[model samples]
Target chain A: MNAPLPAAVDWPLAVHQALSRLGFGVIGYVPDAGHKRLIELCHGDARLRTVVLSTEEEGIGLATGAWLGGAKTALLMQSSGVGNIVNALGVVRECRIPLLLVVTMRGEYGEFNPWQVPMGQATPEVLRAMGVLVQRADTADEVAVQVDAAARIAFGGYAAAAVLISQRVIGIKSFQEQAAQ
Target chain B: MSALRRREVVRALLVNRGDLLVVAGLGSTAWDCAATGDHPLTFPMWGGMGCAAVTGLGLALAQPARRVLVVTGDGEMLMGLGSLATIGVQRPANLSVVVIDNERYGETGMQKTHTAHGVDLAAMARAAGFASAVLVREASAIESLRQAVHHGAGPHFAQVKVVAEKEAITLPPREGTLLKNRFREALLGASASLQ
Candidate 1:
């Protein structure tokens, strides 16, 4: 038999299964390369409904609505998208809605896109300021654990929680790399 | 066909609302909803101007057995215009969006919005792949719009044009948590506690 896939390659599946087990029926997101595999799994799952958002703030709204309707939901976004969600985060904080934000890091280590730096660097702080409990995971093995913790903090407590997956886990996509492709 | 009054349209829309859950955008639309008499089923945004439609989308998806209606003003709808594309693609049949288009930002001192400058929201909804979208400028059209809001096969969009006239504000509960808990209790009953 072929060798099992590496943990890095299998982490997306772990995250997906974790979300399903935690009872999240909806996944809302803006398109991001770092989340491609997770997004694909969300789309493929028969039990989950994937919502492609025009802006990340819309996902915040979706999460609030899902909570009121007694359904669980998660948001998957890139760090830059976190800036777009700041004002909308008020609903989650003030209303005490349970929210899970899975963010993929950029501009953290060996980042090529200069435009991503400001927001990426500010993401954790911004989320914290908005009253979101923040957790970081740098390796594939850490992802499932962090996600599980986040879900408990979010759903179990009716609070906002974020799991920021480091770029080291997603890999650095340099400008040169894109040009080569 | 002349534009219908905003308050009249809102009243008629909620006339036979039944078990429908309503999400109202900030400013005028929120006041309009409150004017209809507050209920636990109606969630009105006191802030977060552009979030109403997507909120309805989430409610629709979560409660497929229930109808979710979003009532928003023209300016608010313009601010969250991208949501139409998302809603169009998701196509939640139980959700409907109604834009009370006065063509001006009433809360911002009657500043003209994009709708006044030839931005057609109904057309945008149609182009974004909404199952059905219509612009209603006449009072006669309100009945058809009401039917669509309550019973139509939707993911529908209706732009109900109105005259830009200011009215006395009718405010809902200011506490977000209170409003949220009230709505949750109404919808989920004893299971409203988040834990």
Candidate 2:
């Protein structure tokens, strides 16, 4: 049956549900077509405020600011962008600020770009090496639950937590439909 | 330096339970994820230069009572050379910087760095007015870390020779806005508390 039509999954809705229950205030993200739907959900949700950034490292500065501002924040970036936030990891560790890192993975499954390979391979290793907790979801079915768990681990433990969303769960890049047209 | 030597130094320093340690660039390349506590905030935001010590300086300034330790790479240290003088002038007693020199940019495909020439980083720190500085090759990390942290004297700088590890591990894509929000939250929260 057309490979299950990719399940029309509500991954972002799940993310919203988890964040709401966890009381994570605002979310800062870089726009990625893979995350557009979730971005829209975060925009519509009253419990969270969304700030968009041009670069991943900007999210680091922003999140640090948010924490200083008395709001819990979450960073949503794709696999390649995490490379841009390595400095933030250094800053955060030094600042001793606790937050959540929600990473939507790219470059692993049927990746088209040669550039994505390096960051994709380094994501988990880098996170682990820095002592940031890492979690991965292989399918849309697991996104929200794992995100909730990661949130608890982050806030309750006061340490950085990461959630990795795989390409199979993210499915094909549908934004291509606009470019194709 | 062998992984064992690096670990020896890290373990020695980490024993000072409540202190904050920030590692920049590939200095964290082989770090043990489970080695942190409830308060450690590790920044791996960008794979670039000069950011580790700058961030460490900020933390030292913001939290004067908390000891802040930065593990930086030689390549990264070269990028932000000006911070040496800045740290000296600020004279934050809680700050200590340790540069791990592998003589190369171990992260981006093993390119050579200024450390290959054996530039005297400790002398540079001294010239910049740091109260204490030293250079220790591979076998001496354990003693150096112990001495640096124990002195509790002032802004301390040390260079540790390390052997580069050749391996590539992928990182997740950029979450630009999210990371900014998280950092902003931290800054704002701290400021709010002061008010």
Candidate 3:
């Protein structure tokens, strides 16, 4: 078990550290602002290989392939992206591939975009419906902890698992946020 | 004179394949691979329609030293078309994607795929920046295809044009987990678990 993290923690860094320590070779993503820091951390570290996917579903396939080839992998995506992997997740469930997903929420808690609601609201149940074990981390302190646990369970049990980092933790994206930058 | 037979093309590709790891796409390609005498190194997709190429990409990325081949159908390839862009970017030299383009969805009542009309998958692969991409319409070219798959510096893509027809069912083990476990064991030996 990993030692308890400090109260004042950079959750992204914490999650990155946990994954690195667990020996994940590949990090697949569709690029999400919520996971920006963690993605950068994995990319910067030589220990991990970063694959920027065209869509979220590719990450699951990537993870499955990497695992079958004897290397561990994880995926990073936004909550709405979860809907994209609904059918593809079958490969993991049927094959018993160990997949760890770190998703940033979009629809709930100070949400600005109406389009994100349907899929984002359906994320957890959708994942559960696909036979994936779901874990939620609504706060920074819980983020790394959930990731660590989820990854352990996924790999250790050879099952599909996900850690959903609440949008409250990722912070809602305002329309003007990027325009100002 | 005509498109190739998928089973024959798959058999030609697998002849004395040695240690090459294959990620067989769902439906006919999986059945085609199984038809060639199932091997522990081959993971035939029971589901996940468009995942074949990226799965091969993942395997290629993971096992850099081992040659990885993805054999999928035209429809499966078309569905995961974006993966060509993704693969083109990473460009794992050991990976090769072979599309069995009969230009029809064989399992789904032989509906015409985009290739049956005008879409050129090989051209799409070329545009995606694959190191080597071609459309193979002759069995005579398969010797070269085998060579490229077995011994080329490639993030290669080959669309072997096959005559779309119903093939006899050659089922591999239906249990997905066993297929995965045996493949990992064959590749990683005892270390499959530790990693």
Candidate 4:
């Protein structure tokens, strides 16, 4: 078998660069193990401000307002949060506000929660139906490069861009990993 | 204002000589406020509720010199009413929120909204910390928007009553995500100025 990936590569830096390329001065997120390092980087950076949201919908709203005020912004959440953001899609579809959303996928590849499966399977279809652009990252290296491209598509085209992180990239966070073994 | 009248008003505003920032929705009023050509940024939809004003607030906070406006629908606004308080606390002078109060979720269907009949939206804005708020129910909305943007200090709110109508306007999708790139560059430029 191949060797496990080293932790020294620094996923947070990659995510930070990706956010910068996406024109995000501020980002809204709901904390999760998949995004812990990324979230810390955003909070620590002076150029980037992190808005911790109570709900996924609030992050969407905050990103929208940031776009209007002349600052580029993005939302970081999990696949579960995508369920909470569906109704708000009408605002972006009608307004054409080009938002960049980076979501950590939960249901694919040894998912623990049954509730997250539907949204995970439907993510691409749902995004396409709403006219959003979606991309998936299976590795941290890909997350950095692909996210930059996604951000360009979002801002350059005035379209919403979504980056979905696969389970492999996130690894396991809790007892779920032990149970999987 | 009728739906058609609202469209005329928005169209007029866009055609006028000045930079414009608008928050649209999948509703009649949103189609009415549709913007064309190269805009700074457009944070399109993904079913997240109550994000229009919050996003608008972010942009306004970043770009103090630019005249930022959020053209949100009544239903969408109600999703994040708490943002009004957030806006109040931040006090972005360049920002103005123009709520197209048709009193219904026009895009999903003609479902009633909380503001379907004179729901004192302006009063709510005032309570949320806006220095000025107004309600208008006529075709003369362009002037009101302009006035609100010009006089907007702290946070400003305006409710424009419109008749319920839903229609789609076809436009080519924007390409390559220049909107986000430009926004970052703009923010960097703003940051440079602060130094």
Best by DockQ: 3
Tell me the tens digit of each residue's lDDT in model 4 across A25-120: 878787777788788888888888677765777666676566545567788888888877776665566556677888887767766667767888
- Comparing 1 with 3 on DockQ, the higher-scoring candidate is 3
Number of colliding residue pairs in model 4: 45
Give a tens-digit lDDT track for model 1, residues B109-170: 89999988889999999999888999999888999988988999989999999988998999
Write the residue-wise lDDT of candidate 3 on B141-164 in tens digits.
999999999999999999888887
TM-score of each: 0.96, 0.49, 0.96, 0.62
Candidate 3 — which residues are off by over 4 angstroms?
A1-7, A178-181, B193-195
- What shift in Å separates residue A37 of candidate 2 from its native position after superposition? 0.9
As for TM-score, the candidate ahead, 2 or 4, is 4
Give DockQ for candidates 1 onward, in order: 0.77, 0.05, 0.79, 0.26
Please give, for residues A60-99, the per-residue lDDT of candidate 2 as tens digits.
5445534544567787888888887775576566555567
Better lDDT candidate (3, 4): 3
lDDT tens digits, residue span B1-195, model 4? 344345655565555536545555434444454444334443333345567677677667666676777777788788778777767666677877878777888767678988876577888888877877778776655576666665546477887777676556533233313443454445445552222
Residue by residue across A1-181, what tens digits does model 3's lDDT show?
Answer: 1112234679988998999899999999988887888888988999888999998888888988999888889999998899999999998998889999999988888677889888889999999999999999977888999999999999989888999988777665577773442
List per-prediction Cα lDDT, in the order shown: 0.89, 0.65, 0.90, 0.67
Q: What is the alpha-carbon lDDT of model 3 when measured against the actual structure?
A: 0.90
Look at candidate 1 and tell me the lDDT of residue A119: 91
